[model samples]
Target chain A: MIKARITVTLKNGVLDPQGKAIEHALSGMGFDGVGQVRQGKVFDVELSESDKAKAEADLKAMCDRLLANTVIENYSVAIT
Target chain B: MKSAVVLLPGLNRDRDMIAALTKISGTPPLTVWQTDTEIPDVDLITIPGGFSFGDYLRCGAIAARMPVMRAVAEKAAKGVMVIGVCNGFQILVEAGLLPGALMRNTSLKFVCRQVKLQIANANTMFTRRYQPGQIIRSPVAHHDGNYFADAETLRRLEGEGQVVFRYAEGTNPNGSINDIAGIINGQGNVLGLMPHPENLIEAAHGGSDGRALFESALGIAA
Candidate 1:
């Protein structure tokens, strides 16, 4: 089995209210050096396919079709 | 005109949509489940507002992939009028039936209230009952009502007159670009909006400004 980790994050220039709230909370708790906190989603999947290359391609297709909203987000997949 | 409502799991406002359509069209709308793969013949299909799939991943992301939506898309492509309210609007966007994406409100809070909306275009099948530039009141309830699109897409939507509604009097509830409250597809057959016209269909609901939308779509003049 091949395991893949997919991370999805909003593209730059898109406003992220939840991330901004987190950043504010961190500052309120005395983490003054924190400049920004952009939120993202992570999905870990185990593919039954043994070939790493094929698993990676399938994961990419999944991300494009369902896992990520390409209009405002970017996704990256890592296979292990 | 015959109408139907698509019922996705976790949908809360399907009943409201049914009631509104039944009262207006004089016939009950057929409810199609999310798992269903075929859609019955209907002139109009409405996607009601609700937290489908518990709003996981994204508000309408999961619902957009449901089997029923495939049928909905097919009918819509053939010129069937489709109206998506709140979560339904999000689903249409996630399904790629409409442009732009809905994000969390800029205030980082769930906003639920009646807001004024200016009809940007009253010539579409869904807005013909209203006069051009008419301002109507409707209830908008959602956390992710803010609409975002690329600059080029925004310009194109404006140029094509696809912007159907705009928040009135600078009351931008969610910081949506150009204060857009609703939009129609290129063929003017699909409309997606954050406001719930289903919640405002009768005088008991404070006003009937939303009724004209249904009446217009069904070709029934008020």
Candidate 2:
């Protein structure tokens, strides 16, 4: 079995309203030292197949097919 | 005015969309699952609002790459009318069917309230039922409903009159660019918005302004 973790984030240069809002809120809360905030998602998957190469392929395919939006979001996978 | 409503695993508003469509068009729409390989032939396709895939990897990101979305995209290319509400709107943007992205609210909170929207472009399939510059009330409930695009893209959208709705005066609820609430694709066949029109279909459900959107699909002008 192979296990993998995936992280997804909005591409740079895209405005992150949530992060902006959090920055403002933090500032209002007196946490003035904070400079920037960005949010992301993480996914942990366990594959039953024993072939690491096949698992990586499947995982990448999943990311390309449905797990990530390459336009505004980027994704990376780490396998163990 | 037969329609098909796409249903993702975590979709919660599919029933509401079906009910609203039935009331306005008198024909219940077919529900297509995300994993389905084929999209049914219908006059319109609706991707209902919900936390699809638990909103795990960004709203609508996962659902955008679903098997059914590819078919939806193909149908959209053939000029099939498509409407995506809330999370579905995010999916459309993520899938490249529409421009811009729906970021989190500028307030960093899940905003749930009735917001006033001005019908910016009444020529599309969704807003044809509304009068030009008409003001209507609808509910917007989302955490990432802030819409963003590059300045050039925004200018083009404005020049092309692709913006369908904008937040009413003094109501930039999500801080979207120019207070945009909904937009249509360049072809004018596909639309994506953060508000939930289906939830406000009946008078008892706060208001009936949402009925016009469905009615427009049936060629009825409000």
Chain A TM-score per model, please list them.
0.97, 0.85
Place model 2 in a CAPRI quality band. Answer: acceptable
Give the per-residue lDDT digits (tens) of candidate 2, residues B10-77: 98888988898888887888988888988878889999998999987679888988899999999999
| C-alpha RMSD of candidate 2 | 3.4
As for candidate 2, its clashing pairs are: none
Query: What ranges in model 2 sit over 4 Å off?
Result: A1-13, A17-34, A39-80
- Per-residue lDDT for B183 in model 2? 95
**Model 2, DockQ value?**
0.48
Candidate 1: deviation at residue A74, Å? 0.1
TM-score per candidate: 0.98, 0.84
Q: What tens digits encode model 2's per-residue C-alpha lDDT throughout A1-80?
A: 88999987878987777677777889999986999887777889999989988998999898876677665678898996
- The regions of model 1 sitting more than 4 angstroms off are none
Residue B139 of candidate 1: its Cα lDDT?
Answer: 94
